[model samples]
Target: MVSAPLPASALPQDSKDRLRLWIRLLRASRTIEAELRERLKQQFDTTLPRFDVLAALYRSPEGMLMSDLSRYLLVSNGNVTGIIDRLVSEGLVLRARRNGDRRTSIVRLTRAGSEQFRAMAAAHEGWIDELLGGVSGNDTQRLTAMLKSFRSNWEGRE
Candidate 1:
């Protein structure tokens, strides 16, 4: 399907505003995520995926089933498996067979892993606060609320 050459701002005014907002949101999110990824690597010699796995385990105290972990992380089972294997080998996580289910395993952070994640969490919080320091608390709250509303609207569209 051939298409005509479009003008720079092909969208109408309101649409252009919404499109600009979306682009700004994407850019801001990417910038912050990139900085956090770099900081995680530099400060803990860890990747975001590893940190995220630990974070999930840390939250689940008793632990989560392997399948559940993958669902919660919104990643494929293979992705979670590799991270879990490494964490298990590093003594940062423990895995055990669930009763009557040899194929399924439960996983959780070990004490060391918990401590390490806590340290990283603290630093991560500070880094975010520093990055967004210029924004007022009220503005932050308003943006968060708006995003939440937007998400709910789309998510509930189903």
Candidate 2:
């Protein structure tokens, strides 16, 4: 029941163009995400959430608090809990009480998890490169800068 998106080319150089740009950006993001999700599942038998958790842990080798991990992934603690539980059961992640503080937990990737994530990360990088291959490096750099500025503009809003 969704209406077809208007063609960006048909939009004038005005507010309509802005709307079209936003729609195009969203569509591109979702398309890439869908493909990435499928590739992660079919190739590694894993989901994007699990891969994201591992990637976060892999970056912070010293480990992170469970709440911090959830925030880093932009997901609720409840959502992260189930993913962590499964990773722990699979021996891909380890959790420990922090310095006799039962209220706090530290989570990190296991050695196996690091190795596995590294492999997946490499492929992921290549996949992104392939998908974005159409864009020239200069254009990509400009687009990235524009997006970063756009994010900062909004994030700074009260």
For 40-113, candidate 1 gives per-residue lDDT tens digits of 99999999999999999999999999999999998999999999999999999999999978999999999999
Model 2: runs farther than 4 Å from truth? 1-13
Model 1: residues with Cα > 4 Å off, grouped in runs: 1-10, 156-158
Residue-level lDDT tens digits of model 2 in 1-158: 99897786766779687888899999999999999999999999999999999999999999999999998898999999999999999999999999999998999999999999999999999999999999999999999999999998899466
Model-by-model lDDT, in order? 0.95, 0.95
